[model samples]
Target: MDFAIGGMAAVCAGFFTNPLEVIKTRMQLQGELQKKNKQNIRYKNILHAGYQIVRHDGVLALQKGIVPALWVQLIMNGCRLGFYDYGLSRGYCNDKYGNVVFYKSVIVSGCGGVVGHYLSNPFYLIKTQLQSESAKAIAVGHQHHHKGTWKALSHIYFKEGVSTLAVIACAYVE
Candidate 1:
């Protein structure tokens, strides 16, 4: 199925993009927490942080969040493509000649992204939190942070409710 192709491509994209995503997360967290005003928030600044990481922690440090990121990306992209295909096949999209419009295809795709992100939010949050500078000291030996995915998920649910869906929704929009 074309959906499988899309899913595989997305997985590939996710793998390649994840390192930069980790760097971006770390940079943003660092910038937010530091007292000094950041002169630049450019990609170059992220690269500089990456360089610093390599200097201090070795190249392996650049891949600190790889495990959780891989989990999230694979699940997210797989479900996204699956849901899109489901929606399209269900006639959520229509053919031309007064049947269905292809623009509906875009809508289905967007919906797929939303659903996939929602399903994958806990993994994403954990990956981001794990990768963040602020989380490092606090999460060290912390039971909650070290807990399994389901446990972390239950914790998030207890803390945020369905309103947590808003965060995923916002991410989808962005």
Candidate 2:
């Protein structure tokens, strides 16, 4: 179905981009909230960051959050493409004359994306948390010691409660 195709495509894309994502996350967290001069620049730039991560944590480190990242992409894209297709089939993205309406299509696609994003927020949160983890010497941001994706999800649900997840997702939206 459209959902499966979309999800598979997203998973493929996520696999290729995950390393870059890992680098980006570490770079962003390296001197987070710190003033320019006061910040310790562990990751000089993208290449350096990638090098440092691999050197410290091994090649696999570049895929630190692959599991959750793939899950996020899969679920989000699946729902998004599926919903968009559904809307198209229902004529929600077409004018009365049966012509495709640009604005209507945009609205339907946006709605699908929003729904997908909302549904995948938890996986995204886990991905971010997991990706931020690194060897202490090269670690950046708040290092959450999540054993894995499922464990992280359970920890959040049991210890922090569902409301915590909602709040985090809402904060990202704003």
Candidate 3:
């Protein structure tokens, strides 16, 4: 119940925010770690980046990572909200007087968020990689030729091992 509602709400938010996310990813990846050169600039700004993606890859391009994005949001928010609600119900966030303790609530919610983030990190990695892919002319970042989220996950697991997944998640934090 709580999980479902939180997941659904996050999905809706993710759906609307994904395009901006796509734009942001591309912009960040463009000319990454390279010397600044005017010629290398493909996306001038958010609007231009969005326009270029639409012109070259169609409007749907803006939602390239929607599947993984939705999954990330659903899993992360579901666990987070569910855990928080469970804590509240169990009085884990309440003081001896039955008043909600601010520090206890923060700790409970933060733990939930951490758990959710850890579980969903793989999807987030896939989402960023997928969103980074674009037409060759407009492509930015190291393009990972992932067929889909599942394939990417499998490839990483099989080729890189389980530790790599954890490493990736940790690296994302830094």
Candidate 4:
């Protein structure tokens, strides 16, 4: 029940923030001087990213990858919050009188969040790629070329191999 409620709340908020996520990804991808050492900034900041995304790609573009993002959020938050709750119930994360032990709670919550992140990494990867593909530097960009999430995952696993599972390792520090 706690997990479901938390997931529901997260889903509701996610609908509103998903567009910002798209804008953020695009913005992060922009202004990179990685190879040539020459900055080519397309968005000045959040406002500009929002404006440019709608102006150039239409308002619908803001919702790109939202489905996967929601799945990522739902599963991630559900698992994170749910497992935290589970730890409390199991007596591993709370004091004898039921007060949460700060360090234990943090460790439990972090473990749960990492579990969620690991499970959602593939979807998050797809979300990131779909959201950032529209960046101006397509020529050198490594954005997934697949048209759908399934294809993207399939391609990543087949071509990228164990590197795909390495996503879980990245989640450990989160």
Query: Best by lDDT, which number?
Result: 3
What lDDT tens digits, residue by residue, belong to model 4 across residues 1-174? 767988888988988998989877876666454445544566778998878877777788788887778888888899889988999989989898988899998898888888888887878878888887663433224556668777787877788786755764476335
- Candidate 4 structure, TM-score to reference: 0.82
User: What would the per-residue lDDT of candidate 3 be over residues 1-174, giving only the tens digit for each residue?
Assistant: 888999999999999999999999888877573455533788999999999999999999999999999999998899889888999999999989999999988888888788888888999999999999999898875689899999999999999999999998777545
Quantify all predictions' global Cα lDDT against the true fold.
Answer: 0.64, 0.88, 0.90, 0.77
TM-score of each: 0.67, 0.94, 0.93, 0.82
Local accuracy of candidate 1 as per-residue lDDT tens digits, 68-151:
677677666776677667876777777645366778877877777776677666677777765653233322122234454566
Which tens-of-lDDT digit does each residue in 30-96 have in candidate 2? 6673555545778988999999999999999999999999999998999889888888999999999
Candidate order, lDDT descending: 3, 2, 4, 1
Worst lDDT 10-window in candidate 1: 134-143
Model 2 clash pairs? none
**Better lDDT candidate (1, 4):** 4
Global Cα RMSD, each model:
5.2, 1.5, 1.8, 2.9
Error of 2 at 109 (Å): 0.8
